[model samples]
Target: MRVRHSTNLTRNGLTDWIVQRVSAVILAAYTLFIMAFFMCSVDVTYASWTGLFSNLWVKVFTLLTVFSIVAHAWIGMWTVFTDYVKSTAVRAFLQIGLFVILFFYFFTAVLAVWAV
Candidate 1:
């Protein structure tokens, strides 16, 4: 029996597993990159910080990191809700709330990264 809903993210268990793992790797790589940036930049300043993000590659990478974060959070949270939330109405409410929040984060990141 397959549960279908417009709000459902991965839909298939295998797809969900793959997505979670890939997103985790992306998030980890992003974390390491940021850590290296901070470590190398001993004298960090507003201009230096902005300079890092101003690079085209870094800007694209930042957007990708933001996307991975949202995807990772959604899958993790949705699994938790399905496992622990017994009440149908409550689970739906929580899932829908999360769905909105994740999209909002993605859009906000896009705007922030691209905006001059």
Candidate 2:
């Protein structure tokens, strides 16, 4: 005989899987857009860079990229810790550290983007 798990738990995994895929797509698209922008530009200067980010649309897209990066990193790190780190104490510690770093990155990115 076999035991069955809760549907909610199953659904949660599926949700995470879907989110990872979506975030990856977003990150890739943003990377490509930035790469193309750089390649097309004849002069790459601090003024030009700042000007590119000055656009409202670019800022919005940059914000979305930040979100995608955070989500992707969280899911990837959580999966690794859960799968490989057998020690509960060690896993919890690592997860807490990851959360702190990711949050710090998020806030810092927001500040830098909006300060411009």
Candidate 1, poorest ten consecutive residues by summed lDDT: 1-10
TM-score of each: 0.89, 0.88
Clashes of 2: 0
* CA-only RMSD, every prediction: 1.8, 4.0
Candidate 1 error regions (>4 Å) = 1-6
Please report the candidate that would top TM-score against the real structure.
1
- Pick the lDDT winner: 1
Candidate 2 local lDDT, 1-116, one digit each (tens): 22222211123778888888999999999999999989999999999999999999999999899988988888777778777877777877898898899889999999999993
**Candidate 1 local accuracy as lDDT?**
0.85
lDDT of 1 at 35: 94
Q: Which ten residues in a row have the lowest lDDT in candidate 2?
A: 1-10
